[model samples]
Target: MGPSITDVPKSVLQDVIIKLPTKSIIMCKSVCKTWYSLISDPAFAKLHFAQAEAYPMVRPVDRRSVSRNLYLVEPEDSSGFDLKDHDCNRSRVHMNLSKYKLPVCHPEELLNYHRNGIVMPSHETERKVSMKITQIDDNNNEVDLGDGFAFMMQYDHNSYNLVNSCNGLLCLSYFFGNRPAAVCNPITGEFINLPHGPKHEKAMTLIGSGLGFSPRTNEYKVMRILKEQTPDTNKVAEIHTLGTGSWKSVGTARCSDSELSFPTCVKGMLYWFCDKWSGCSVISFDLDTEEFQSVPSLPFEDGYDVSMGDLGGSLCLCKVESFEINVWVMNDSGPQKLWMKKISIHTGFSRSWPRGVYIPMKYFENDGLLMFNSRLNAFFYHHPGNHSPFIYLKLREIKYSSSEAISHVPSFISLKDILVGKDVEILNINSRCAVLKLPGETEALSLVEENASF
Candidate 1:
């Protein structure tokens, strides 16, 4: 028998809600009037929300493959976790490209040939191209899941310019001369254009732009910061929220003389290292409340400043001095704890932290890898490994530094190529791809054999 409401302890009731998933807790309110009242209370809701925040979701690391060559050479056991006495040594794997009918290219040569930081356009065109996302098996061959399925925005031949990709969506800023800037999801091809605000003569002076999703209200927001030229010498800031279709002034923009960097969204908040007109401060924007708050100033000695980076799903402040690099993870509220750990003090290009490099705007590859361009070197940081020591995978080398004009390159590969091995009794292709499985089928051999011909 259930205990009476008067006999049940409030602490026990709070524990029950806290242990349940956020979705389940909301559904519990429908069970009874007392349960509804308890769950509907703002204070109780806030408490549960806080608990959820405390336990941020951690994705399981796929122990399948690590590198391209490794995946091909030994498709199975590619995780490298089973390799005993595997120290932090930079080791290269050898593979015969010709074995898998792959192009005969040296690992280093292939790495140098490709242009690194280019955002693959979401739009489709005559020549379709696809990039490898995850190595499903260790065969060293890619399971090219059609270009659009993995991309965040619709593939547009024209109109789409990738600024940067963060989390799952890409931060795209369109330049139609006098047209307003538009942010979009490359995978789903959904986009929201920012509204034109007070016209400024010098829009070129703008330094940073960013987009973030608020799960609480299911809304996406974009923020832009521009350095204004005037006798007053004060920075200006503007923000735009999708569906509203108008730019709203936030506050006096404050940023350093150095190129302004975009805000980093961490733990449901947008944080920016800014030099406010009054003084330099780390400003944080709360997505839930849409309010701005200031963080404690960074402690630096001898005028040395620290740059911010994302560390293990948290906002990190990085300090580099000669050969030593220190990464500090922010723990604003906890057991009065702030974790300051040293990632490496090694000497070489390998020691350079790629996550700290600022890209205009970028999206997080489906697997949480960051793709960006710095000078001639295209850089990628795959987050499958330890977050601090970001694996700096080179994408491509830039041949020319011409005008930064936007161009679209579509994937030539068909959607049919991606669904090769997966079991599909009923395959439906329309605007989006869907697969239906048949009962009593242990495996789908015919589909795998047909795709193998490709």
Candidate 2:
């Protein structure tokens, strides 16, 4: 390399690094400490993220080659690559479900757009005594969600629920009995309490709750839907705006015996399935207006075993039938009739694993690969283009009984940066953490003297 190129200025170097593919950036981080410092900086990360957002066309993954060697980028060019797609708190609600010998995927971990597939291999069931969160990154590599995140919540792993996710923020509810909710940036492990809404004299099963962001108002919100049974079912709506302390009433809606799955937020609006006596309809609540309306219903019949998910960046509904799961993506959000049946995946009986249900955890819109787990420690990537073969991906290290993976987007935005009016505190994890401090942060906030060294 010539001296001019070798001696590239820091500003010029920043552009070069930002231009590299996501995997290359991680590789470049190890080239030298200077490169690591530059690439890992919060400001640089935000700039790189903005650049990636500007080019949003996701490219599909290649089936012929599973190795990183055949890595594909946008426009089918790896040179000027555009590899598409794809936290926390402590007091860690580390749920180790290995002892039960049952499937332990949590619907609550579905907190964001790029849902992470949490897994614990079947072999290592002993780690439940010391629970750990296993998360899969974009490169198909697994990362642990350690630090006091689970412990900070002070709840048994079974009681924690991931409410909603936007941009990169996550809302989690703790409910061994109490229904206290909190919003936190899993990357930075910075969280603030959301004021408790209408108190319950006795513990009750919450209908569901969601977290969202309103770009127009520049605010984040936590919406909880409470249901009471025994005396005919009735539903109550309560909302808490981030940066604001208390939750306010959003009025109430009549409840039905039919099932309503968790909410998925899109463009500042929250949507959930409303299975009423009338029919199955998708009910949406505008975050900015705080108004509720029924826009559209599922394309299928009322009770067809349906589940909602974020397919890539679009809102998707998955209909699970006998052995095939039909995935429908809402191509155009403007009209209710624009649902395009993108793909159908066959999950029929197999000689090796019969009757094991494989659920899609992360949908790679660009590459057409749907990541899933049929059982504990068992993970596979299903490419819709090719149905006959399923590519197996393995999770190494940290084997507990239960594990969770949700769609996650790594970001430079800190909790303090988003929560403008509120005070922020970092949870002290009683365990060791691999990554500490928010990206671009100096001196770890609330530095626990013993475990400060990352």
Candidate 2 residue lDDT tens string, 1-454: 5575446789989977776545566678788878878876779867865655211111111111110010111222233222211212221111111110111123233222113433321222223323455533222244555756543321233334455456656666653322435665543435566655655443334565777778788887877776655575566777887776667879874445444554677777777766665667676678998877656556777644665656666777766666666778776546554677877767665434323334344555444444434244334445544432344443333223333334434344666656647454434221222122211112111101111111
lDDT of 1: 0.39
Deviation (Å) of 394 in candidate 2: 4.2
What ranges in model 1 sit over 4 Å off?
1-166, 174-180, 199-207, 254-258, 274-281, 301-307, 335-339, 348-393, 396-454
Q: What are the per-residue Cα lDDT tens digits for candidate 1 across 181-300? A: 554322222333344566655433455666655668656567666665554455556666555645676875545644444357776677776543444446667666666665655544
Model 2 alpha-carbon miss at residue 318, Å: 1.7
Position 279, candidate 2: lDDT: 66
Q: Write down the lDDT of every candidate, Cα atoms only.
A: 0.39, 0.49
lDDT of 2: 0.49
Question: TM-score for every candidate vs. truth?
Answer: 0.44, 0.62
